[model samples]
Target: MTAETAVPAATSFAALHHRPGEPLLLPNAWDHASAAVLAARGFSAIGTTSLAVAAAVGLPDGEAATREHTLRLALTLGSEPYLLSVDAEDGFSDDPGEVAELAHQLWAVGAVGINLEDGLGPAALHAAKIAAVKAAVPGLFVNARTDTYWLGDGDGDGDAKDTLRRLDAYRQAGADGVFVPGLTDPGRIAHVVRCVDAPLNVLYSPAGPAVPQLADLGVRRVSLGSLLYRRALGAALDAVADIAAGRVPGGTTPSYDEVRALERSVSARASANSTG
Candidate 1:
């Protein structure tokens, strides 16, 4: 579909957060093909992983280096069937207006949501960026992320206190949701849920609580941030090693036709939607 046809998807993606007991399981994609395959598999919403985007382009993540690449990917996947949310690491700038402009461009390209991280910076600055993005494009779901826990070098009590403080600032600044990535403890998760009025987004940890557990703890969004990308890389390496060792690689590898079918289905659906 054209970007115009994808405009209403923002509302649908916003509604996904309000479904109780079923947090939006947001699987992040790195590029057009990954997003299309996930959309074909029936994921209503897909997020872009900044790490994957950076790694794919041989750039380092979290350094505000992949702005152009991020925009390019957004332009490519903007019209897909699934709702698109971009993991814009720190919005690629410290200036609130610049970050808001980035949000504007993403929205214009048909992105429904944007994730902005504080990177443990000053909470006030991060809040200003959120406020700017909201003012620029209020329809975009701003998942305001605070890395206090993720980057904290303090005790649990101190980290929780700081995280709550940052989240409060973000909420006051008009964030649609708040995310604390490194938080894994059930008690801490429940505490944050109780304290925050907006939707609480938690990163899914393989060694931590599962989706069901996170749902039980009152998380509105469960994001698989970069895990799929990392796993894909790992699988590719393992397959190559197995081939060199003369052992059959064991994994659910999709056939070439299946992948091509995903591409064809996307094109067909876009054509049909555009015509309708």
Candidate 2:
């Protein structure tokens, strides 16, 4: 598949969440090259990072400001061979209908999944958004996110109760999965996994459990979130600093032709599809 050519995938994106001990490790991509390289390296599904998308356009993440930029990226990567899941902050609106419309547009452009964060907003409103997206595009996987942990909720009875409450509400609203980005405690993670009815999705934190540990705790999806994008930016700074100091960069860097080959591969597929 290319930007203009979509091929039916053998496995559904939803299925990637349920391999028992082998949880889906979704590396978030910021642009074509990031996504293409991940796909080339055997990741069957890729998600966009909201922070990267916002940064790319000089906007802020979680402000519902990157809607158009997000859509533009979906247009570019949706038709790729691997599954594409977009990080659409709060669905870019408070209106459930508007959120549903965004999901429809993403799906129409070939995205199979979308991530919608509640941003510590009203539970009812987020649930409504999830319900609306499901009603409008039943085939599109909706990973409903609650910011209870993301907003700095610590490990307490109150925090656990609130997190469970929001996750339950989102599940009832037809969310295929639920994400809690800041939850890291092994016991707490296991507690939520056993309690939440829907598939558990958690942000992969450096301080938190690894993929195997997350799988052991029953987390179905582990999202890298904006880690890769942030690391990429950090790497660029490191490389330039190294060159300025007369030292070679240590990280593996792709050659100019290698990057060009990625573009040509997509172009070749587009040409084949257009003229086939």
- Best by the TM-score measure: 2
lDDT of 1 by residue, 47-78 (tens): 99999999998999999999999999998888
Report, for every candidate in turn, its global Cα lDDT versus the true structure.
Answer: 0.91, 0.89
The per-prediction tally of clashing pairs is: 0, 0
Q: Lowest lDDT 10-mer window, candidate 1?
A: 1-10
What would you estimate as the lDDT of candidate 1?
Answer: 0.91
Model 2 per-residue lDDT tens digits across residues 9-58: 41378888877888889999999999999998999899999999999889
C-alpha lDDT (0 to 100) for residue 78 of candidate 2: 82
TM-score of each: 0.94, 0.95
**Over 4 Å off in model 1, which ranges?**
1-7, 262-276
